[model samples]
Target: MKEMQTFLKKYHEEMNWEISNESYEKTRASLLNNYMLLTTEVAEVAEELRKAFNFTHSHILNGMKDSEAFDLAKENAKEDLGKEFADCLAYMIKFANYFEIDLEESFYKKMDEVKNRKNRDVSLSRK
Candidate 1:
């Protein structure tokens, strides 16, 4: 992913697309779409909360209901958010391709940088 970002950055510089790199544009688009999905998730959670706490004035009860709402939120994450997540990845790859990225060379260079890095420990920590 980082390799792709780097390539996109280079492409943008070479093409002089100064507002944003292609990769960042894709990411921003993904984030915007993801935000829409998040709002829906919030709405779902709020509806669940209303159902679970329509009679509850107790703080503890409300908290538990909210927890249950979040459990439902987790389900929403797996379903709707998951779809958006996949779409984001696809868009990123498409962006890379659109910029005529040589992913193989980019990936190899990234690997080389990783291997040669002084902060080898930090690279290991990434995964």
Candidate 2:
């Protein structure tokens, strides 16, 4: 998707100062020992999802919900989750780029297959 590419371009430019091949390699060595593999991308996505969930539910960590803490959590969750989801998307886009995959076409194809499977299952069940 062009939108994904656009977002990725912006994100890459914004993060250029902080991200580099050496840093990536170090992270890869620590977490995966490989760069830009599907398994590594999946793991990064899962970690980002966990981070977003943690930020959204951080009020629970206080043992009891303080009104102030709950409000702060609510306020921060939106921004934090946005950042985390962006990170997830970045990894997915990177994975697609590394494999030279067209995500938009693949997405539609998979959706069509799923729809066909659902329709076939429903028709059979009515027999």
Candidate 3:
């Protein structure tokens, strides 16, 4: 993950896509714009899921088994889903790079914190 982040940092620099830090206003605008783009990519990920679900439903209606239809739909959507996820990751890495944040370290630290935290939701069980 760290290596990927480093690679993206250099890639973005080479592509001249890094967030601006020229002035406070410029930095603010750049951050907001990038955040919006990230959200758009996220929506594209959701769109891919919707497409897969619709495709699976169509196949099922045509008499295909549920699992087989879903599997085929999932496979068909995999490439576009991956591309959307990559787009999201690129924007996230860009923000992390701009802030000098070590995303790999932060991710592990956060996961550990969540792991150690007490669960809040109560389990429902039938007697």
In model 1, which runs have C-alpha deviations exceeding 4 angstroms? Answer: 1-61, 65-69, 102-127
User: What C-alpha lDDT do the candidate models reach, one value each?
Assistant: 0.57, 0.60, 0.95
Off by over 4 Å in 3: 120-127
- What TM-score does each of the candidates earn? 0.33, 0.44, 0.92
- How well does model 1 score by local distance difference test? 0.57
State the lDDT of candidate 1 residue by residue for 1-127, as single tens digits. Answer: 6566675567645865423335978758755664565566556655555543543434345575666655655654455545555445544544555466666777799999989988667534545
The prediction achieving the highest TM-score against the true structure is 3
For model 2, the stretches where C-alpha displacement exceeds 4 angstroms are 6-76, 118-127
- Which 10-residue span in candidate 1 carries the lowest summed lDDT? 51-60
Residues 1-127, candidate 2, lDDT per residue (tens digit)? Answer: 8678656657656865222346766645533432344455567656655664575466567564666665665565567556656655666666565456788888899989998884464444543
1 versus 2: better TM-score goes to: 2
Q: lDDT: which candidate is best? A: 3
For candidate 3, what is the total of clashing residue pairs?
A: 0
- Over 5-85, each residue of candidate 3 has an lDDT whose tens digit, in order, gives 899989988998889989999999999999999999999999999999999999999999999999999999999999999
**Against the hidden true structure, what lDDT does model 2 obtain?**
0.60
**Candidate 1: count of backbone clashes, pairs at least 3 residues apart or interchain:** 0
